[model samples]
Target chain A: MTEAAGTAGPAGSAGAAGVDGPGRPGPRRGRVLEGLRAYGLIAAMWIRSTMAYRTSFVLMTVANFAMTVLDFVAILLMFSQVDALGGWSLAEVAFLYGVSGVSFGLADLAVGSMERLGRRVRDGTLDTLLVRPVPVLAQMAADRFALRRLGRVTQGVLVLVYALVLLDVDWTVAKVLLMPVMLLSGAGIFCAVFVAAAAFQFVAQDASEVANAFTYGGTTMLQYPPTVFAQDLVRGATFVVPLAFVNWLPAGYVLDRPFPLALPEWVAFTPPLVAVACCALAGLAWRAGLRSYRSTGS
Target chain B: MTDGDGAAAGGAAFIELDGVEKVFDVRRKTGFLKRERREVRAVDGLSFTVARGEMVGYIGPNGAGKSTTIKMLTGILTPSGGRLRVAGIDPSRERTRLAHRIGVVFGQRTTLWWDLPLIDSYRLMHRMYRIPDARYRENLDRCVELLQLAELLEVPVRQLSLGQRMRGDIAAALLHDPDVLYLDEPTIGLDVVSKAKVRGFLRDVNAERGTTVLLTTHDLQDIEQLCSRVMVIDHGRLMYDGPLAGLHEVGESERTLVVDLERELPPVEAPAPARVVRVEGPRQWLAFPASASAAGLVAAIAARYPLVDLSVREPDIEAVIAKMYAERASA
Candidate 1:
């Protein structure tokens, strides 16, 4: 049988004409575009799947929207008792809250499902993703994407609009351009944190709570003025986790407020740089985690 | 042998492993703050070469490294030492590239989306693999026709029976016309009819497309019907590699002969090397080497006893493998 198979190799090769050999690495831009296309395809399928249950989808979206609204209502009640919080007025605090909310919301919508990496690894689903032709990161990030996450983004935009109508600050061309930059860089930083924290699941399969402390906890802490926290906590947020880059420093410049810790004005322009560095570090962590992966027994 | 010799021999060796090894570190908590770390050699110094267009059966007992070998071939788990290659590409280094040329199906799990219809997963794969629209449609139509998936195409994967889901998974793996297919327990937990259908479809696929298949199965019938060459592994090492007929000779296996007499009588007086191993009332069973002819033994028993009915049973592959393992251990 082995001899017959060896003799039929040429005929087999002819039948497999449609199959390609090991593919050469394509150009960087082409690969990036291909990854994006694949991500879009997978995410669209998830959205359609979620939309299949109309009442459930609508109820979940409304519930999510209502829950986030009450979070802001707590701040309203706080202002009824006091004039300002940590030397920032109601509108300034609202601005901070809005920026952090929108940034975290966008990040969650994109890669929040990554928190289930521990479960995937334990259940052997990661092996399925590794065999696909697409990038594993893209496949994981787009898995089970829920469109209801847009609820939080809509609420954040509303609050930001209300704050813009109330606060009176001298707006400039740079500030106008900086608004979109801050939101995008903020989202980038949050996405990096989500991926980096999830990467630790490869080593400790049940350590999802440690990731939640950094992601959801960090967003909640960022909603208030940085001055309200301790000096050491603020320093750690600034240097170690870089959560301050999400909105605090950039919003300070936009609001023309004094820097917390007496920092220079140039610090506000560094959010983009900080976001890039954080994402690079997170990419490294993800790669290392993939290398160390010990798949479950079959 | 060196890779130079392998490559110089021919390109027929599509999948080659030269002393491939995979060792896992397992840490167990023995006491309070005292742990013991140990190395588990799941696949130790395994080597084999599978030629293209060969449908080979890889069978072994549990924890014998069958799944581990398939995982290494697909690049899901990298080997710790030695060399491995498929289509002249290192699986670990160029997994994504190699993925385009190989297809895999795990019967224990489904790659299809749980909430989506069967066709939806195939459509997602169409775009994910960037397969040409014409080729994708052709392959999907062929698989659906052969596997009888037309009635189940619109049903959500979660609602399908185990048999239906297995067929769905097999179709998903082949939509891209991959050069090689790795199936780990494809017909496990399946009914008799489902197993036959799957086997028939696989035979058609191999004969028509000439797709190379490496199957890991606990079901010996899956081997007898599909594969011509079989490799037996035990304790992370290859113990036997030859034709299925040769495995019986190596294990010194035996076939059973049952003889039913006219009435309750003593054990049948069988010939030498074919003694009655068991007797109940008028029925007696004689054991002989599987390689020997059962016709002469039947004649001898008929000549001595008043036989009413008689039958012969072939040796099962599991018993052959067990005997092989026991012989190695005792030696």
Candidate 2:
């Protein structure tokens, strides 16, 4: 698609379109819609770019699925040796594992690029995002959109569906409806943690591996019932990082299991609220990080 | 130029800075037990105004804070103190708002996605910037034809040559039709042909679009070919700001005259202002003030010796800068 642009000699000739009296500020579209469109376009471009190497992408996806399945295999092997661990049956723990796995995989799909913020900061490439006309957060999310994460998410959802069909619990309508909310809000919570981790890079000026302890480690911990953990460790995950709000508590409510640590039943429903608060706090930390970035650009 | 109005009084300033200062507090560990904190002033009291439609060159040695100033202008780094306004908007405070009006290219790094095809990056920009479809197409078509990038559009950025990637980056920056373009060392690692192509493209962009440009490059030829105004900074201070011609005079630079004599002889006795600095075989080299008229020296040498052929050489900017730095240090 080509049109003869003014093609005026190598000197200033005001082009009619694009250039005019005072730039016209390019049509002020609705901010949310603009962000969404830009994000979608970025993700599409990333997918296309990945698809360029179709075989590699496919292999990586398959490998991710296989690797995640091994986790379930290990759990199954352990369950074979014993009927139950910490009073929860193997099938019940699989539900917990599936929910946390899906939530984490989904969040990784959205915000995994935050994990590389340290490298971008160290190399000064983050400046490219800063110069663009979009929010840095949206740009960061778009910068690294991995389709391979879907493999793990698919594995997780499959495990979850299988667990649901086989479990003897009476499936309530509320349980069915809240399952999706749990997954989405759980993803939101993980995404918030990722953003908060990115904020740490501004101070460290390098990739902070510490964030993985919560993001990946929290998901691993949630794969088992909190009752299996030491009291202090369970409390920390529940109250300190609120990892329990992501899946364990919600899964407990759905499975009709008693809450660990003497928590009320309402806490299970607070994933959405907790997720929102976490997002707000992450946003504040992200802003503070940006401020520090602008001040001390290292 | 079509931008004669911008040069006149009462014209709107496209970029303005007043006493801008950026001080970095660096903490270094002296040992396991002790550390030291010191404030390194990167840019101190930097003040300049760029008029609309002006293509200006910003030059400085390493660590002279050229990149820091560019960062501040782009709002990537905020100044420690002072006020800065680009198109009447404070850059750091209204960075996202200002982003729509400005385009930046960092020659050392790319803004393009690494794995995407060259055209894919441009396509992403079309949406990211919300560029009108018609405008995006027109700009892309122009850049492709002018940059000779049609064959490279489908190539992944990682596979592209540095020069090709640089051209792609320039095209990406312009697709949005930004009002101002900041190019930091745009020709840093490019070959001669690529440099010429880039310089010509920049000249066209500046002239046709009236995009106010502030170019920072180590390549003096980039400034010589494209910029009418040059600003030189040293030690976070404006050492010189004027025409490229005036830089040699400020640096107290000396031009060399290479004369081919018919035969090897003793050092040729030239006039008072010009003296033979080197003699080898039939070639005699003389040093003269860069500001002095070379015509008289040529005539004087021609009369004194059997001059086979003679060529006047402008002082290379590298030597000019070295001399300037030496003088600045001694002062």
Instruction: Give interface RMSD, per candidate.
Output: 10.6, 11.1
Evaluated at residue A232, the lDDT of candidate 2 is: 94
Q: Scoring model 1 with DockQ, what do you get?
A: 0.30
lDDT of 2 by residue, A1-298 (tens): 0101111111112122222222234232333345556678888888887898899999999999999999889999998899988999988998998999999999998888788888888888898888876667777777768899899899999989878877987778988888999999999999998989888888885556788888888899999988889999989887788888888899999999999898999888899999999988887788788788888878
Pairs that collide, model 2: A11-B207, A12-B207
lDDT per residue, candidate 1, A1-298, as tens digits?
A: 0110001111122223223233322333444565678789999999888876889999999999999999999999999999999999999999999999999999999999998998998998888988887667778889888889999998888888888988997899888888999998999999999899878898887989999999999999998999899998989999999999888898999999888778898899999999999998987788777777833332
- Once fitted onto the true fold, the runs of candidate 2 whose alpha carbons sit more than 4 angstroms away are A1-30, B1-10
All candidates: DockQ:
0.30, 0.33
Angstrom error of the Cα, residue B38, model 1: value is 1.6
- Please report, in order, the local distance difference test score of every candidate based on alpha carbons: 0.84, 0.84
| Per-model C-alpha RMSD | 5.5, 6.5
Cα lDDT, model 1, residue A93: 93
Worst 10 residues of 1 chain B by lDDT: B1-10
Using lDDT as the measure, which candidate wins? 1
